[model samples]
Target: MTPPVASLWRRLLDWWPRIARILTLAVSIVVVVLLVKLGRGIDWREVFLAARGISGPTLWAAGALALSGYAAYSGIDYLARRFLNHAQTIWKTLAIAAASYAFNVNFGVLLGSVGVRLRLYRTLGLRHAATAGVVLFGSVTNWLGYCWMGGIFFFGAVPRTLAAWGIRPEATRAAGAVLLLVACAYMFLCATAARRRWTFRGHPLAFPSVWMALAQSGLAVVSWNIVALILYLLLERQVSYPDVLGITLLSSVAALVAHVPGGLGVTEVVFVDALSGQLGAHEVLGAVLMYRVLYQWVPLCVALPGYLAVELRARHASCGAGGHDLPEEPYER
Candidate 1:
């Protein structure tokens, strides 16, 4: 590439994250202001009563689902740690992941997964290379499951909610099929190319074992579906599970791509837009609020103190810039 062109590309890459964050923050603020204006007409008493009317058994089910989903979320990092061959204890790794994930759910990746995980992992003596590996692997693991699950949902059942938007079911099914193909391709490559090294732009590519790849996809699907079931139960099963799961998968991708902190305003908007066909806007918002309380707010309340300890440890860091605890060739095959 030409010098000017290459420099422009480099600059764009550098500035992209900052630009995305600013745009996401602005969108979130706009959504909040709109909600506040609309809140004037909302019947809080009714909403509260509706939530209160839920059976105790259903509430217990939601709590169990939340805990299970969280455990599965932490398992993504567990696999990453194992993949990196880090010596951190399983409990320590899960704790860090759980805390960071809580922050990620409420805050953005910058503060939660990227920032919090970076600080906590460093204090445990991991170097930059190993830390990056964990982050990358965790991401890959989550996406692998999302694609397959999304594909299945899209192909197996057309979302009645999306039909209101004039989207063709056939088109949705085709897109889902594509996702399935991509998912299958990844597994095929892993099974055929494990331990093989291929380099791009001077950095080597690594593939985990097929079993590890399967584990990643399975864990992610489990985490995502449990969360969806929680929302479904919150909505009193007004919508079909397939419809809810499909929308949930789409929202997960949107939240990640938009980098909307905690997905604060983003998730509600998406849920209302798609789910309003089956449930009233007030009902949709109510269910989302309940979901937020369980999935984001409660965990965030706990993660705050845990992250505080992480900050304290960061002040007296035990980590090294040099690959001290890392293997000589740290990108494990």
Candidate 2:
């Protein structure tokens, strides 16, 4: 039997995750409410009309871009699993990832992402310790990709933005250098982790081959840039590839911090700040708001039905004595 203090500690530790989840939910709700109140100028009728005006071809192209991004993400997972020698089915991987993204779009990204990975590995009959390693590797690799993209954009684009804001060129260069160093440091750490087989909580994490990581990273950047271009096209009635890339990178970096659901307020603010010079204030607001409705919410609305359909079918396939079986615990993975 455990001592009373030890038992108390254990109980707290057991409930800690649920407590964290509840706090996240509370924060998400509050932030969303505040953002909605602040950005309340959104004209629902105008948004509706604007959405209707989106041409079928344009919608299709946007969806295609999104699908391409999903595929790249799934591919990254597959490669990671392969590298780890986990040997899970590709369809299982894809479904789990799709569920993850869908959950991320609805719930907060961190919880949804981890939850999806937990379930995916559990369902695939992977050990909890191994699953933990896979999740850690995948996260670190994806973030390395993010840092690389952000670093390139910082060096190539941010100095210009800063210079345009009347900062001295030398100052801008210095700032860019700092950003570059940070990004490089992050990449170095990730590389070290991958090469050394870093462990988190005693679970050894392994990354895919370097070439595979880089290829997936490249695809992720391109896929995101394409989505940004679509939004730019919709808003400005034109697309600037450079602007799209820069804004995409900026928004991605910002999203990591914002922690809002789907990076809601944070992404819009970053896009507006990045594009204000080219598009002006009102247009930036309008464009970002409009982009959110279509590129963010609308797709979620559409995809959710498909997700539900898939889930229901899956449920039906799993026979039970009386009712459906409950999902196993995360620790049971």
**What's the TM-score of each model vs. the native?**
0.82, 0.68
- All predictions: root-mean-square deviation over Cα? 5.4, 8.1
Model 2 backbone overlap count: 0
The CA lDDT at 28 in model 1 is: 58
Colliding pairs, model 1: 106-262
lDDT of 1 by residue, 174-288 (tens): 9889989988988987887755666667987777878989999999999889989999999888888888887788777667666668776667777877875577667777787
Off by over 4 Å in 2: 1-44, 159-207, 236-239, 280-295, 298-333
lDDT of 2 by residue, 1-333 (tens): 369987898899999988877766765565566557546655556545655666677666666766666676666667666666665667877666666665665566565568756755665556666566666656665665655555565555543444554657565446557656765655455566655756655865444445665665675556556566767666645436666666666556545544666776766655555565775445555556556655557656665676566556556655652465545434321
List the global CA lDDT of all models: 0.80, 0.60
| lDDT minimum window of 10 residues, candidate 2 | 324-333
